[model samples]
Target: MLLRLLLLICAPLCEPTELFLKPSPSQTIEGNSMTLTCEIQPRLQTSKAQLQFCFFKDNGALKSGWNSSPELRILAMWTKDSGSYWCEAKTAKATTTIRSRRLWIQVQRVPVSDVSLETQPPGGHVTEGKKLVLVCSVAKGTGNITFLWYKGAMGLKLGTKTKHALTAEFEILTARENDTEQYYCAANNGFGLSLSGLVSITVRIPVSRPVLTLRTTGAQAVVGDMVELHCEAQRGSPPVLYQFYLKDVTLGSSWASSTGGASFNLSLTAERSGNYSCEASNGLEAQHSEAVPLIITVPTENRRDLLTSGVIEGLLGILGPTTFVLLFCYCLKRKIGRRSARESLRSTSSPLPQDSTYLNSPTPVPLQPVYGNVNTLSGDDIYSLVYSTQLEQESPAEPPRTLSKDKVSLPIYSKLKKITVIDMDYDDAV
Candidate 1:
């Protein structure tokens, strides 16, 4: 009987007096639901036994009154819902209350959103050998975000950054021409991906000394031939302007919007033979090329042709009129000689009809006095005038009976055949 009484006393102590609170899905998400339950260590004696349960978080009650239900439902937990939580269990007739140990609940946040990419300098331009910085930012996000930077549509990965801050930076020690391209960034917090807009970058390089080349069809450059001036910069940006020069005089200018070389064509002349050069610029420092000498040559065949033509033309111009004048003078002299011969023939053949009788007499006869032209004298012609006078013997007594006069005149001959026939004075008897 004493053993039975001891068992009865231990039986009351064995009844469940502890309250336990358990949560389904111990790890919670921001938009998910969770359930918390309050229970005894063992099963309740009967369903009719009146029991009450209530929930508390961070030492604050979740509800004003306890509920008959053992389970508490928390729908849509947020980041702020993360804290310490516990539950209390009590009987309607008993004055004793049981409490469970405190449990910590943590709710995860959403992924990143509104991601953007920017640069240290406002514009997208960057000079060579200068520093370049890329900044990626998130407008709204929680937790550690992984940021990745990409270049161009081919998605060439530049860099990656993981941090809890709103923004991240990636820097290039020295920018170069190869670094010029389109860039973007992406942010991910293990939930969803966010992409930023593209940012264009251009790296400017100073123009290098250009190379000038002269192109021609033949081996040697000649006058009146077309020559091409090709100017190229091995390293420079586009939109470069190339200028051609001859002895410091500007020939022309060419603009290359997307190429490294520009060309200018010229029809060469003798005066164009000089030192040729070129310059290249892209809105930065300009560079000049070395001067190249160009000498024009004349072909041997062409020179010979020109000389031959010039000599022939000059002879024709000078001697043509002179030959014509000489021929005219010769013809005039021959005509004058023929006229003189005709006049001489007429004078000798035609005319001495009046002297026919005198010509028949053997002795010379004096004719009436006649004057003849002195210009008609020939080698056998005679030209003269003579006078004859006679005196009587009575002249001593009478003082000369008026001296009897007898006058005779003879023709004066330029060439004398004989001189005995002609006398100037005559006596009474001779």
Candidate 2:
């Protein structure tokens, strides 16, 4: 009974030691070694006493019965190794036992990935003075992400956004000339960073009011001349198509891929003279220019044919009068020939012709004009009488037996440049 009382009293006399665990680094990379140290408070160096250490993780024992030195070393660490740890300190004499507060360790991992960029409206094209929405995203990634947008190489940073979502977007309130270029984005997490591929952007501009121009080498436009109809805009996108029209009819079309202007070549003709207009389009809205006059003047070379025709007409006018004069002279010659023949027939029938004074006397029969005009006898009538039987009976050999001086015949003749005129006088029988 005295030994039990002594043991109870001594059990209360031994002091309990404090224990703690210390990790070399609070955080470590995966596949890397980490050291954990178990230490006792008020370190004991006396030779009379023996002590042991134990390590624990997440309320479970990891290592036990460490002798002399109070330390536990880990070779490598993985994701599962992350947890709360502590250490236990005790005396070998079964006198006291103690534990330490928990120590928390964290592992870092993951980086941004699959960075890309796109635009709204889906056409990959847009008009000037319009809005453009740029959409950026990541196909796969973890942790908080920071997205940054940039223009072409060595370009300005458009904007940035910080979020945990897999996607983000930014809108360009109004697109400007500088907006037409290549663009890209970057996704960054604390672990790493990734850059996206380049995306091309085409900003369409409405063709400004077109200006129609006529290009020619002559001071005055004329037929058969080489003419060029050019259409251009003050500011517009390339690959523009230009159409030329004359009097609202399409003349030709041309295209320009590198500039804001296009032109059409044409061989001018008199029939092509009229108002001309031009239109410009770049796969957007078409812009038309005001009509400009293109009056074709007459060329001096074409007037040769007209002058030749006038000369031929003058020659015909002169020939028409000469033909009429020749016809009159021919008729006179025939009348004089008929008169000479009748006079010869009279001289043959009569042995002695009477004095020619009767040729100058008034005729016994009064002559009256007939055929076409009642005033005078026409040339045709005289020619018909010469071929008819009336002339044969009238000039018969037995008509007048007495050779009266008053009934004698008279003949007058004159020579012209190319013709002869004659006058025959005959009196009516009384």
Tens-digit lDDT string for candidate 1 (1-430): 9999867644543575667788888778766899998877765564524778889999689963587888889877777788998898776664667798888888878788889999877688787888989999999777678999999988899999998677999998899889999999999987877999999999989888999999987889987799999999998888899999999999999999876599999998767898999999999789999999999876687768767988988998998899899999999997886667546544653222122111223443443333332333334343232333322233234342332234222333444542112223322322
lDDT of each: 0.76, 0.70
Give me the candidate number with maximum lDDT. 1
TM-score of each: 0.43, 0.46
Q: Superposing all C-alpha atoms, what RMSD in Å does each candidate have to the true structure?
A: 21.2, 17.6
Candidate 1 worst ten-residue window by lDDT: 350-359
Candidate 1 local distance difference test against the native? 0.76
